[model samples]
Target: MCRWLAYSGEPLRASAVLLDATHSLVAQSLDSPMGAETVNGDGFGVGWYPEGAVAGSIPAVFHSVEPAWNDENVRELSRSIESPLFFSHVRAAAGPPIQRTNCHPFRWENWLFMHNGFLAEFAKVKRDLTFAIDPSLYPHVTGTTDSEVLFHLAITHGLADDPVAALTAAVDQVERVGRDQGVLFPMQGTIAVTDGATIWALRYSSQGRSRTLFHSRDVPTIREMYPEAERLSQFGDHAQLVVSEPLNDLPGLFIEVPESTIAILDREGYHHEPFRSAA
Candidate 1:
């Protein structure tokens, strides 16, 4: 399992959420109270669309094989860069080797994708899944992790045209392939994808129990609740976050995303819909 956070809204330093929060993404990397593994030190990555960039611009990514908390560069980069939309992920290698390529926030063209789950018995169905990817995308499958394969599969299934539908189809394919190989629970995890303007997050599992996922309460509502909390002043009304877990314990600061649901965050704010495999 892994832990990740996606931020969309105001242009703020990545460090505001990555390092400055009470239970920041970096903090989660070392001591995640809600993650399956308390320590997710296998590797880490961050991707962000530059503030003021034109629409559809490709986001920048920084990846490392070092544990996030131990990496000086992660600290420097997060503190220096500010983005209106960004993604940060800390990895806990389940079976894949620790390497830069295996880190989350995988990018293709102008879209970025990350996942906090795994495909069960990946080795058994890896070949089938790999062959299923459109050949044009198969060339970009640089990493061996099931997460990367899942991203490309979504693209092959039409992520650019319709993310929710594409994701559902991709999961269906994974479950169908895994069950064919005799694996009962074929998939499990939460996922987030963005194209610099909007973010789409999904929480689902083949067995019905998915990993924890959350999104921040709207900034205006939080400010009204904690009138004197200085921290709430940093974000604008539209600011929102979808994370693997709540960044802090503050009541009403975050809302848990229901299981088998897809949370879509855009200019209008957060909207959720039922999400299940098409199979």
Candidate 2:
């Protein structure tokens, strides 16, 4: 499994979440208290939309094989760029080799996607699953990770038009293919995807248990609850984050996204709905 987080709302330096937070992404990479793996040092990546991006602009991605804490480029980029939407992930390989292409925050057009967890016995269903992807999208899937494959599957199912429905359909196909291959549990993981305007996060597992997923409570609520925390001032009212683990120990600041649920974050606020199984 891996650790990841997505940020949306007012434009601020990516470091606000990747570095400045008490238990930042870099900190989580080294010692995650809630992840499936404690050390997510296999590799890391960050994707962010640049300022003035239009609807179809693809976010820039920076991936490296080095551990997040040790990578100077990650440090430099995080501290330099300011974006309203971005994604950061630190990986602990479950099966795929640690390489740049296999890093999280995979991008396609205006979308950015990342996942934490693995497809149970992926090798058993790889052929069947890969062949199910849209023929046109097959050429665009440049990586060899189940997470990246899942992204293309979602796109193939229409993520560009309706993310929730498309992802649900994609998961159903994965589970069906897994069962056909005799695998007991077909899919597992939490997924986060965004279009630089809205964000959607899902927590689910075929076996009925999934990795941790949490989103920050409304910033104003948190500010009122912990007025002494000076760092909270840096974020705008709409700023929000959905992470694999809480960025800090604050009790009321983050809420766990329930298993088999989808959490949506937009200009209005964060709301969650039970995930419907397409299978």
Candidate 3:
């Protein structure tokens, strides 16, 4: 239940999409054609936003409990750190506990988040959504995943003023405590977030069958429909990507993020709202 990718355009090198795409993101942690596990080796993370900080601060994470395809310090720090905002994940430990703070894009203060899905009955609705988080963001939820307690319950219900209504109020507080303890389809995958200047992705679940997600159909309109694929002339003019699949296999390059959407990329270009409570 893990596979993630998020970026905010034009700085390149995080292996040009987390390891030179052709299904990269470290080759989908070893072949994940839309994961429910096809070898997400259970521990990986990468977070960026460090190229002269000091604006709002906080964005420089690099976790590993090994197995981001055998991390050699995540391939020498994703080819020597370059950023325009980033987030990466590759773990499939369904219920949690693999270590390294449950490896993900979870951070705060300049935001960053990640989740692939599953909160369904997280040990009986995880103590009523962890005592309804907000005791000053409850010691920054140092890990014990229900995807980092749904990213600190969307930073205590207000991810800097409406991140899809703070993630639909953390899925309406986990569907009002997993439907009074019956827990039908509580929630499922696909969530990505950022604050190093706008980026948010979400697809939904609650049994509407949500899983696979994709994006990246704008890189100058696939560089004028593959104008001789010069690696699509190195991304800019609002480069975009929201991946959970399709890193390459051209033919009009990637789309399909429906079923309760939210996808909004920055630097202007790419929108798709309507997951406002499944509309």
Greater-lDDT candidate between 2 and 3: 2
Q: Using lDDT, rank the candidates from best to worst.
A: 1, 2, 3
> TM-scores for all candidates?
0.99, 0.98, 0.34
Model 3 Cα lDDT, one tens digit per residue, 149-233: 8888888888888888999888877876887899888888789887888888999887878889888787766787888988877
On a 0 to 1 TM-score scale, where does candidate 1 land against the true structure? 0.99
| lDDT (tens digit, per residue) of candidate 1 on 17-89 | 9999999999999999898999999999999999999988989999999999999999999999999999999
Which residue pairs of candidate 1 clash?
A: none
Give per-residue CA lDDT, model 2, range 156-204, as digits (tens): 9999999999999999999998888888888899999998888999999
Which residue runs does candidate 1 get wrong by more than 4 Å?
none
lDDT of each: 0.94, 0.91, 0.82
After superposition, candidate 2 runs with Cα above 4 Å error? none
Model 3: how far is 212 from its true place, Å? 7.4
Best by TM-score: 1
